[model samples]
Target: MSSPDPAARPGHAPPLRVLILEDSRFDAELLTETLDRTYAAIETTIVQDEQAFVQALAHDRFDVILSDFELPGFSGGQALELARKAVPSVPFIFVSGVIGEDNAVELLKRGATDYVSKGRLARLPLVLERALKEAADRRTLGIAEHRLRDAHAAADRIESRRMALIELSDHIRDMDDPAAMAYMAAQMLGRQLGVDRAGYGVVDTVAETIVIERDWNAPGVHSLAGVMRFRDYGSYIEDLKHGVTVAFADAREDPRTHATAAALEAIRARAVVNMPMTEQGGLVGLLYLNHGEVRPWPSDELEFVRDVGDRLRSAIARREAQIALTAFAASLERQVEARAAELEAAKEQLRQSQKLEAVGQLTGGLAHDFNNLLAAISGSLELMRRRGPLARPGDLERYIGVAQGATQRAAALTHRLLAFSRRQTLEPRHLDLNELIHGMEDLIRRTVGPEITLDVHAAPGLWSAHVDAGQFENSLLNLCINARDAMPGGGRLVIETANLSLDAQAARAADLSPGAYVSICVRDSGVGMSEEVAQRAFDPFFTTKPLGMGTGLGLSMIYGFAKQSGGRVGIRSKVGEGTTVTIELPRSEMPAEAQATQPQGLEPAPRAPAGETVLVVDDEAALRMLIVEVMQELGYATLEAGNGAEALRWLHSGRQIDLLITDVGLPGGMNGRQVADAARTGRPQLKVLFITGYAESVVLGQGSFDRDMHVMTKPFEMHALARRVKDLIDGP
Candidate 1:
């Protein structure tokens, strides 16, 4: 304030603002004109009374104050006191004729800057110049003192916090118990930081959970001491996981906490600071400060908090390491050598046993399921054979039917296992699940049992998915049956369909790519599963049902099917809250085709036409011979090949082959696909039928080869293969 006013510069200088308290307008104008001689420009305000003078001083800033000693009701002495209170830093001068030198010196001692007598009006310029400069000096000195006080206060605060942290470090360094150290650190932080509560929480990054045992709290404040799923609070937990210090001034105002602001207020955490502690490349713990009032967290406060947190971590570790060392030293001579030897041997045996156990569990479960199916097939076949010539009328056919039924079930089991491995052959169709669910509603109700309630919530304008229809239906039925079993006393089962557009955040959470997807969610209101059960639900051979009641492969098969179809599956279950299994598949761009209805009657397969030559290729000698024999019985001339090379040789021989039948997986130099590609070079219009167990065979029917190509999985009935061959060769 002591420096010259910025507005009073050399060029284009502002007017010297002066307030005049005089009854005579003429004297005021003469006074202003007198000061204008010393200053380039002077602006004057003339007040005739005490009220006007006080209002002018309050409403404006002036460089100088000029008052007449005599006023109608107010004296210059009285005006001086008011001016000293209103603008103490501005110069006050009296330009009065009646004021004597003795009186003037007395007034000057009373804080008046200068006096200019009416008798000597020309000396006014010199008097006014000195008054303004002296006022500027006093103003400058006042500001410097104010700044010095602030700097000293800040330094004191910093030193206080630093000493507090050092003392806390010393206290925690000697404490052997981690809990005691943590609690003491929390208390010191809460008091030093002026917060309502301070605490440290143990983190479990693997489970994405946090647990608090104890914390320091102010009077009447409750502690958040227990296991917690931070996800229930808000999105800021992710920041904590990344070792970021999350600070929010107000829970209600921050976007991250807005959804649960009321819940935050309940814990007196209207504002918060979460300092994450990370170790071994993962979040290990959290040091938190909470308050009921919202306040700005400055950079210095945050840095100070981080320093304290680091010191706390080091001191806690040192104490714990000391304790460990003491315990190790006390027992060193007694058991160290023998214990070490025993531990090594036990570890090696444990590792070997673990490997054997895992292998045995998987193989044993698979063999058990397969043996059951094989027994049914082998039993039915031997019974029919033993009946031989003594067969009752219509008995052989019935026996054959039993064997066929068992064989079909065996094939289904193989497909389910393949699905669980994500290797099942798929015939993906563009399907609107709304229509599919509607069609299956009756069957699903019956399968779940008459006691269970079924509701299908098919969203309008649902996107279609490109997936294997048969696999999708099987997965759905498996889910429904599981739901039914969960609720022994029947409950509501909801099948919900919806379209979702996931962004990167949500997609990462769901372990999927960011894009549009169609989701089918099956939710059951029944006796729900625990966290442990829900986690292993997708593991093959891990089921919870009683013996002979369920094959744990159902969920795993559904999981594999979803993944193989460029999708994801997730499950959520809480005790007494029921379970929900959700499958999210990528939305298909193509239009959905209407499902074809099955006919009530059967039609026999057509025989091969004249000049229809069919080539049969397979790696299995028995399977190839069977197919060749079936072709022979159908009156089709066939060339049998044991491998891809042998089949290509026949095709390249310029023979008139009407259709080529090749197994997708073959030994020797090439597979069926390669063999077809080689032969198609000369015969581009060659009709081919691919028999595969791999869904990669989708390339033929659903993708690139949209014409003159077909596919069927292995282990098909001879009659079905016969019809397919005839249709490809003789029909369109």
Candidate 2:
């Protein structure tokens, strides 16, 4: 290693010290001669052996060392290694005549500065020049690297300050609470960034006076709230006057400054930046940033402070708006909740109303069927009694009387059922109650039987009530028969019709619509009903009669009918005292519509003629046999097939069948409808009759029967079945 040659700079002081090791004395002297001629300030030391090389290195400092590859006691590689340990920065070179390119190149890798060949001594001065130049370059690099590391550290500090400013601005912008937002922004600038004191003051721009809103001073600093003024005689006034941010990089000696120097000194604040919060070119407030130590503010950082002031102004205003919106949303939610609750209540009321209406409809339908049956029984009995001698025979009269008593009791129960069902059809007609009762007298007498005495009590000129004549008669007859049933043995049955007006409270107590009405009452002495029986007596099929003798539908049907007709049906009974049923019809305000024209009489059914092939297909063999017998009696050729499959097979066989009578529900893989379908394939013009003990109406769509096809419920009378089939087969 060596210093730059002083002589190379011309008038430089001395020769740099240089060391040379060579196997050949000629090469060593050659290098020394080159240095001596090219550099006026050349100093040279020559070592040719390992011992000399070691001694020379420990004893001297040289500018550079020149070594030969082949030596007496050491190779150039060995000497080079020893030389670098003693002077790590010193330059070394190889001078060798036997050194091929490979060995010369290998020696240079061992930290040799340069290489010279004995045959190339003319280039020795050039090699010496380069070695010295390289030594200076290495030293220069060390100094440059040191300065580069310092520059990087300074750059990181600048970036960190920039990032902190950005984050502080973001924090202030995001604040939603007005007071809290100002306080937090002040704290971040004062505490986190080592400011001595920080505060925000709101100014009434019109009044131009500072109102200290939020402030934070470093530990042991006194409050500065009222001490600062915005109008006059203060440093903040200068900031307000300019409407521009003011920076005091060093607050120690400013002429425009007032007591702030002493105040900052008291708080140990060395510098300050006053950022003005302005909007629309007018100052609104001031955000003061104070530093605890003397530090210069970077331009970017000073700029960021102004941005934060702008954001703070917007944040406070926006927060107030947000609070207003929240209140409005809450009020809207309450209104919606109230409306939803109201709607739910209305829906419940509607459901209850619909339920009542459906119950009324069911009641009306059941009552219609019940009243028809009563009419048939009463009419038949009345005709028979009128033509009979049994009325005079005491024993026969007693039997008749017992039957009549039971019938009256049953009818009474039905009246109550019709009432509950709300189907009591009240016709507002100008009709005398006495006349109506008189018209039903014959039927009532027969229905009550000879054992049960029939009594009619009619109020004179009994008020004409608006009511269905047919339903009224049926209601009366139902009461009579129910009375008769209650008195299994002979008993007295009485019927009465009168006029009455009901009051509102009475109507409500009975759950009836308030109206005026006429009343018909039927009383009988028979086995009466208990409280439990009376309560559910109007429920369909709730009967105490033997299973085969009574269907509980009687009373429920009557109760439903009574209600539907705009009337009230009432019942009274004691377990052993018999019962009385009363029906009240609303008094007539409008006349009832005249009855529609009806067929004068049911046409006598045409008979199934002899030689007519009537197919009877039924799953039940007994039913099939009975049907066959009926068909034969009617002078028809009867063909019987058990089950739908057998029936279908018979029809497919091309049998001459005129009418197909089949039970709806069948076994053996086919139902009556399927059989009929298959039969129609063979006999396109075949007429089919479907019989069902269950609900055939359901299996057949509502009124789905064709004009030529008929449906008959099972357990029908033999004559009725024959007649229905014949009428269907004969009529269009």
Candidate 3:
């Protein structure tokens, strides 16, 4: 393999640079010498370790990587991985001793070009030659892909341009005035075809008379603007008569041309291509392309000229017909403008509706969470106060006061969110709409501001609605405030009340019931909404008002409350005109609840009874321990279990347990609810208090528990759990 070829053909190839990675110095040196002797152009670089192999690759580019499968510190796979990362496109091939077929396949999958056995030094050159050819093929494929993308982009551009031209042609055909259409057509030609001059010329075929009617050119070409004679040219007329394309590479040099030397000089003509226009066999006119410098016309350019000539001829023929169509187009334009205005109004309405809807969803979710927290806090506080001052003495009254305050505030917040979500527990009663508005008149006036004029238009015999008094009052107030903000420069705000009875079809269409309802409409002469705003009007937390000024929750909560109460909400707005928000609440048949003359807060009366040995079970040590303390202070001996299995184990061992108190979420095989269920089965007399952190966890949902099973959410203070336990043990 090292000997020179006897049939060697000299100077048949360029020098091939080979990167050789081998651990053994002796074998690398031998292969280098052998390659130098065998091939006239072969430069070899040898690196043993993976680091040296990688460094060589970074410093210089290589055609192929040749490495051994095994080395002292690094293997072929490691070198191959490093080489691929450095130069992803470069090919790699392994040369190792006794590598199995499976090992070779693995190397190939990892992007090695090919593998050659160690003793086959003679095949090394052949291997390198084939690898380089494959690399070249890959490079060729990559270039072809790039060219394909460019070609596709160009084709798309051409298609788009053609569509634009078609639209322009359609617009021209719809015009009535010949002179106007001709002027517009000349402008179109100058812009689309990059022409210096565009004109309409009248031609008489038999008489060979070509008259320029109207010309579009430089500012002071009035002499050439009028009709001109072309009868002197016989061959030019013949070319037009035959529909032949006439070309003059150089007018002075073309033997078939008919212009005099003076005329040619005045025109400054170099290259000219003229396409004839014909309707049937007779010639109509000619379209001309004149270049300042001498140039050959491309076939596509001539085809374009022919197309333009045909359009010009058809335009001239329909000149009178176009004039009659202008009135119809004008009417269409007016209709379109009116429709656009209507669409704009509709869009603004939609935006306001969507904003209200978003707010409703947000308020509903927030109220759900807020309610749980309130429940825990309130229950815990009630439980703590019943235990008296015996357990924590001096601190007992202070803790009770703080817990009660927090519970009240929490309830207030949830009440607001629920009002927004339209799911608040309602104590609905028949209410006089006129009287309610009259009562809220002062508040509404203040809300709308000094700049805005408040107008109340209550209809006679206005039906009353079944609504929560506080929420109804708040909703009206929110609408008035929003109206005030919208009319910063001052506008008229109108509040009116009326009756509405939606039919079955209207009910389904509006996603409401077919029933009578009372409406409170609030209209403001503020900046009206666009269509986009109207769609999102009811979306929770969606507001156009600057951040701090609006919660974006008011309208949404109102919308939810309306729907949940078997009624609906509506909005109307125009850009310059203002917005109207109307809220409808269901009518009630029951007599109205009399308004209380005064309101009072609850004061702590007396300590309640705490009896029976209650079992408090929880996985959290702090919570379980807190419950135990609360129960013990309440004069009840408490039994505890961390999870279900532990509780079950205690029951199985015959431990006396009165009531089971378990955490809903547990680490063992069973959850708190399941544990409670199992414990109740073993101990038939067991009462349970299920404590949980998540509202939608194991202890919640439609079928998760029996109606009577007591449940409480976590993050609760010691008192809430104790009161709930006492209540279950002592009864309502």
Candidate 4:
């Protein structure tokens, strides 16, 4: 190392301070003079002994040290050691005559900066300059190394703090309980920051207090859980609210903590770090760290505390939201349950109202229809009575016929009412719908009239349905008649039959069991019904027909019959378009039998079997007498009873009764079917005939009858009655 040339300086610089370690004043002055000869400025301190040198080194700063190799007591090596201890960064050079190369090399190795021999007195200035330059370079290097160590230490502190914050974040994230998370955060922060106590506080602006939610204290440290109130800390809280960290090395002496000093002293806190926690730009609380000894909080530690505050705030907010959401869900569930119960109650009320409404409609329509029949009967009977003796044979016969026709119409209407009420008995029989529809083609066309075109489309191999054949045919006729009335002019009427296989989905939607079905659809192009009218089409007595023009039980009867026969009915209609009514009946697994086609016209009264005895029972004496006379006229012996008890008496008496004829609705507490069942105990094959104005469904369950049994509605012609009796007597 060599000093820069003094000649290269632009101006005079500060003097170089030098220390001369020598016992001889002459040598020291000589050394100084040698340096002054080349240098512009110099300042020197000369010491003679180790004591003098030690004092100068301790009290003064120097650039370089020069010493002699040998002295009266101390050697240059000892001087070098003393200089090394006092000013380690300063250069030490030996300028002694007694010092040889070996000793000089040893001295340099022993921490002397350099050695200049007395024999080379002219080289002293150059050597001294070099020593001074080297000393300056060494001082710069030492400062840089010290700073580097400090930087490494600071970086390590940052990394450790960052890792602690990350661990705290993870712990908070994994915890669901707000209280637990708060306590855990406090504990982790206390350990990370090496504080005696750490705690979380929640702000209560309204109360002007900060509630200490959770706290963790190290061993032998007091907890701060009960400490609260911003007023206790005077205006210090205002600073925290404005996002300033409140820190103090000594709480007892800090002006900002004067109001809270007593409280701090109680907790044995010498220093404190109070970091504000904020949410949505408003101060929510504070994160507090308390130290039992005075501690100067570094900027990094303050920043870390702030970060923990943020994490705790977020965790608390999230936990609160979760609790609120759970409560809301429970409330919603309760509300839904209450609403559903209300809906069910409302639905039941609606159903009851609809039932009452249907009953009213039924009674009104029935009254209207019966009144019309009664009017016709009453008029015809009045006419007969008026024309009694003077009336021509033709006039008398016509009036009687009119009365009979009216009575028959009234009976038919009653039967339809029973059917619509779903109380009608259905005698289910395996029948092919396609064959049945085809057979009724001519009859349907005639019923619709010549104005309407009839199209019968029966699917081949149509499935068989189990339904009462007579009731089904009557239902079909009622549908056709309705179609005819719908169309004032002319329209195409299509009768279609199809085999359907309903899958699970379709069956569930239709409220039917999944299986095969047979459908009979009656479609017509006529003035269609609107949605409202169509919806009530199946309601008894609900009709769009003009008053007195319809009984309004036409569609209703069909709907009931289909349902009673284990089936459902669907109707599709649009205003000004057309209507298609479909009856879907479960497919019968039994093979369909070929139906016997009878002559359209009624046959002449058939004769009863010879020696056949008939028992006729009726509550109405006239009807009973009439049946007895008809049976006797057909060459059968006849007995008569007004009630079931009388007939049962004859049956129990073991009388030779060939056939039992009884009214279905008897007054003596026993109906026709019960008497028949009673008589069958004695004669299991006994022949019985149920004649009634009451629907057969009432007397005979499902309208089903065994062989040798028959049912005939009241108001039937004499020929029909005789024919039924004859058929029963002569079994197929």
Best by lDDT: 1
TM-score of each model, paired residue for residue:
0.51, 0.29, 0.33, 0.50
For candidate 4, the lDDT comes to: 0.81
Model 3, runs deviating above 4 Å:
1-474, 489-492, 594-606, 609-732
Model 4 worst lDDT window (10 residues):
1-10
Off by over 4 Å in 1: 1-356, 600-602, 609-611, 696-707, 730-732
- Global Cα lDDT for candidate 1: 0.84
lDDT (tens digit, per residue) of candidate 2 on 109-173: 77778887878888878887788898889889988888877766665555555566567657766
Checking candidate 4 for backbone clashes, the offending pairs are none
Q: List all candidate RMSDs to the true structure.
A: 35.8, 42.9, 29.0, 48.2
Summed over model 1, clashes come to 5
Q: Of models 3 and 4, which has the larger lDDT?
A: 4
lDDT per prediction?
0.84, 0.70, 0.69, 0.81
The TM-score, computed over Cα atoms with residue i paired to residue i, of candidate 3 is 0.33
**Which lDDT value does model 2 have at 489?**
82
Model 1 reaches what TM-score against the true structure? 0.51
Model 4, span 1-732: residue lDDT tens:
123455655688766878888888888878887877777767788888888888888888887888898998888888888777778888888888888878877887899878887768798788877877787787789899999789767766776776777788888887888768888888988888788998888876657688785689999986667647777655577787776778898877898787678777677676988888777877787788888888899877877777777788888898887788678667756766878755665566568668877777778878888888888987887677556669999999999888888898887787777777666545568998788888888888778889999988889988788888889999899888888888989999999889988999999887788999999898989999999999999987787887768777888889888877778899999988889999999999999988977757977799965868999988887788888898889999988887888888888887788788888888778888888888899998888888876455657665567767777766788988988888888775
